[model samples]
Target chain A: MTGAVMNPAWALLAPVVLGVLALAGAALNGVFVARAEGRPALSGAARPVLEVMRLMRQRRRVTVAADRLLWRIGGMALLVIALLKTAVIPLGPWILADISVGIVWFNAMDVMVWAGMWLIGWGANSAHALAGGYRFLAQAVSYELPLMFALVTPAVAAHSLRVSEVVDAQQDLWFVVWMPVAFLVFCGSVLAFSAWGPFATAAGADIAGGILTEVSGVDRLLIMAGRYALLATGAAFAVALFLGGGSGPLLPDWLWTIVKTLVLLAGFIAVSRRLSAIRPDRLAEVAWIVVLPLALLQTLVVSIIVAVRG
Target chain B: MLSIIVFSALAIIAVASGIAVFRVDSMARATYALAVSFVAVGVMLVMFDLDYIGVITILMMVMEMAIMAIYMIMFMGMNPALMPMSMVHNNRWSAILATGIFLLLAAGALLVPWPARSGTAAPDLTVAVGEALMGSKMLVMLTVSPILFATIVAALVLANPRGRYDRWGDNLKRVCPDDPQQGGLGK
Candidate 1:
């Protein structure tokens, strides 16, 4: 909407940096989770990296009668979805794509993650993995509509589906201040879709890693890393859409972006640890009965406010 | 030149993946293959500057594929990979039918007199779609609204074999409603 406020040079590195942080943040979340569970935590911050190294060195494992091609595709797609999602986020003033319909682009990428997770589960050819896959699709179905509705409030408030325009519209007040319900529903859906924290039923430990039961070595590493990246991208998007992208006074715009993303990510990780995994059947009821109505209400209020203001 | 290259590549991808759909052994692979083909079409749509429609295409297709997989699992019974059943059937007749339809579509595309451009297209096509839906074409939405609601009702009815009255009672006094399994929320 306006001339570039951030250096174009930073655009290229932003995704790479975001990805690395996602990996690290995921590993850090593991540490937090370990400490919370009263288990011996890994020695240092390098634990996640070290774990990746171990996975790379270890021989890859495949389940009996596994569909290797689909498995590989599933494992890889998560990271790709995360990267594509981050492309729409403006780290400062410029985004990677800067498309007019950036918000929809983000939505499109997330929907791909639905297919990705299911693929990972189905490809394994194990009952656990297949069941896990089934569980996630239910979770995906449950949250996706309400999530789409939640995504719409900011777009309605700004009267633009472009991510940067949504940010620009928050000059006086962040949408989250007024649209708290949408924000909360958004946070819950992010957890649901990413299959992390409370919504991690797909990989709930009871089923011996569920969809991940048959995954091993480099594939597991990629899937795990990709999840963190997904979470990180979600946090980055939340920053742009709700927290007012790069809007802080003291720091450089990009710095604000990074800080806000990290804070939200950490908050997600912390919140996830406190909550038990939500069963799919239960989640479906809550998603349809509760969150769906609230999100629609939030959208209605935002639209009414926008019309009145105009 | 770039547009041509991009379009050709995407067209190839879409066709190949479409063929892969029938060829794939498992339902999961077919679902993904269709999704991939739809995504390629979506990207092609964006390349043509129909960004809003393109993204919506990608969104709806992914959700559809995911839902299809679930229905397959529910009705078909057992693992898709292990099953390995061919979705293709009626070989000669189906192929002939497909070829005839393709020819008809291609002929229509090549011979039909297209309408001339009316005005400069809006750069923000999302807004354009919104205005058309809310303003001039509001009746289209109104017509669809009841159908959409009916679809939801139909879906719930189809998916739920036993109604709440069956689970609870005529008086609706059952506390847990005899759930097969426990939910995350007690209700």
Candidate 2:
């Protein structure tokens, strides 16, 4: 199936759709939290809506000598990066901006999180916030290489960097079936970049919310929304790269895309809750020595298979 | 017409932010201003259909700048990097040098006897560019990269204070390596 670039007018819908998916992820996360705390699931699902309303009314917390411009920009950049990522991700047969280097485009956007998270911490001018920012960069140093290798595996298999071609290559056999290591590494890196679940040390409670220490009101709202949006975007990308995007029976292609993304997103949220936070310092050795090599091996295996098939 | 407008806008941003790198007081701001300048240049490359190079430029520059800002702040003596501080020093001579270089480059651009295009553009500019850069030297490229990586790994191993002997035992017979901090693996 040829993936056609949709009308430019549909570009506006990217953020709206991303926002909805993010809301669903948040609701799923809320459900997990509710079950853990022994609360009603329905109420937990509606909690994000109430949170938005509450945060909208709350006053923004201003820090002494804070770089407000950078702080605000950092908070807002996450959601913008998520939306930019969505541009390269096709929903079934339709895409926005069908660039030839879509995989690299997504990689570029994810790397922006390094700058964004650091600025969020640095801008607050608070000790904890700055520390949180540094922690994220440290964690990033470990995860970034593995993530890049994982992305390269799919591109190597498809012999194309375009998202549509990657999806098309998976029509016969899902890449996830053979490249489980890359798939797992991709999922883990998505969590790491989003600073969610086990990788949430950058915003850990021990550091008094870390990069989130000084933010409040709409600033806090934006950062929180950005985190969920990144998670949703990562899940959608994983579907396209590994799950054979829109290749399911009975349902239309677009619907299948949505369904697969939701399922993966839910898995992400639930799994994150199950695992405890990993300290960045501790993670560095394991990531580099173990995870990175595994990821590289996965890429090597995929490349060999592709070469053999050809 | 639209391409012209976009190109001009990006060029302006690149220059403005490049200037901002020295104008900004804080190290973080200066570092990110440089990042913005690079990002603008990267987008301009994308406009020229160098998609892979363009996107990789944005990826590398942002990551480099982020790390650089951290080191700049962390290693700065007297904590001046975190405080309000000038991003420039010896500014007068530097300005003169910068202007001299700019004029030279601009003159070269304007005066160079550039030949008119003789061949059609390739179907994929990324592949074309890659072939142009590496087609003949593919063996050298592949060989040198591994040696370079090996050197880096070797250097790090030698420099590491807590090597395997230190972590494990001198005889390398420890059940759990004695360490200052526990790793995620717990092994």
Candidate 3:
């Protein structure tokens, strides 16, 4: 139902590609973070996978008050959301589940991150961990409105909520140039939802790694992997939504999609290095007062432009 | 046959989780149980090809429960390792009320005739909903948005115990509220 539909087998390959991309992005983020802390970049790059090995060998530690069932659920939920979110983006011309409501699907999948983060926090039953969970919920409330507004702007410009349709609409004029505010808000919210860099308040170092403090062993590895996957998938979605998907001259569309995603992912990693973690409470106020209004205005402006053009 | 299998599996899950919501002792488990129930309903909707609405249902319910979990943690938080605590209250009344509502709903489902399939399920239901909202019912749809804003304002007021007066103090000279945590504009 999309342009230049390809063999369905590519769907199988998409996950592998996404996994590698997410790992690479995580490595890049590690390097940036390492450099900022005056550490060796090589170790930083290898850290995510290395941590997985270390965590695998380590015995699982459970807090006595911790809800074991919910903890595992929380850890699994993150990876599930990441995978679900990836299913929406068109890797080439088609995706695993190219549903008509692909944009909404992306949003829906992302909403699962809320449960994932909170469950892990609440599961730990520790003060710091619980606080981390609470922080993420507050942040989610603050950023969700702006994020929804930003997401809707592209749908308005494209005249469709489908990701492929949005990409198709951007063939002429990219939404980023016109919907700049929405793009900015989208980036900010993406960082927030993924708990990356500046928006990493939920897992900040202050409360002893926040929700992550009590988690150890394979559980920690899974959560970290899920987080990297979330970050990478979000970057991919940004490419599809704002950077005009695979639309570019002198290259295959799929290649362009990959390149754009990598660039955006690298930018995210670098940007996170430059900014310190935002305080969740302060962020809540700013989100409602500044970002939400700005995002709404962007949507209004885009809707008007679309109306006028039509 | 396939539809029957899928719907049966989904219905069983939904009902099981619904029962688990009350049966689960810990607050977190209860919240997740409710989430699981809602997710099952969402999946059932997807089975009917209502992708947009189903997905939205799943998203909204998960986020809602996650928020609920946070609130539970904030107020009644203790060591999870220490003891498993029961969160259910007004159990007898709740059970009776739930049973009554369930019976009423079941009666309606059995007594009332469900409408026959209409127009081959429309190729794209999302577009139809959008057109219905933006095309004819735009005014009604636009009017309801303020309710959401009202809810947000109301929630913020209720959640924040410290009022503006409490924060500013009597003289109104303090640049920042002396929140125990500190770190705002002043910091």
Kept native contacts, fraction for each prediction: 0.80, 0.89, 0.64
In what order do the candidates fall by TM-score, top score first? Answer: 2, 1, 3
The C-alpha interface RMSD of every prediction is: 1.5, 1.2, 2.1
Docking class of 2: medium
Collision pairs in model 1 = none
Ranking 1 against 2 by lDDT, winner: 2
Highest DockQ against the true fold, candidate: 2
Which of 1 and 2 is the better model by TM-score?
Answer: 2
Write one digit per residue (lDDT tens) for candidate 2, span A1-310: 5556367999988889899999999998888788778999888899999999999999988889999889988999899899999999988888897788999999999999999999999999999999999999999999999999999999999999999999999989999999999999999999999999999999999999999999999999999999999999999999999999999999999999999999999999989988999999999999998999999999999989999999
Model 2 chain B: ten consecutive residues of lowest lDDT: B71-80
TM-score-wise, the better of 1 and 3 is 1
For model 1 the TM-score comes to: 0.89
Write down the DockQ of candidate 3.
Answer: 0.51
TM-score winner between candidates 2 and 3: 2
Model 2 ranges with Cα > 4 A deviation: B100-164, B178-182, B185-187
Structure candidate 2, residue pairs in collision? none
Which portions of model 3 show Cα errors greater than 4 Å? A1-9, A33-40, B73-83, B87-187
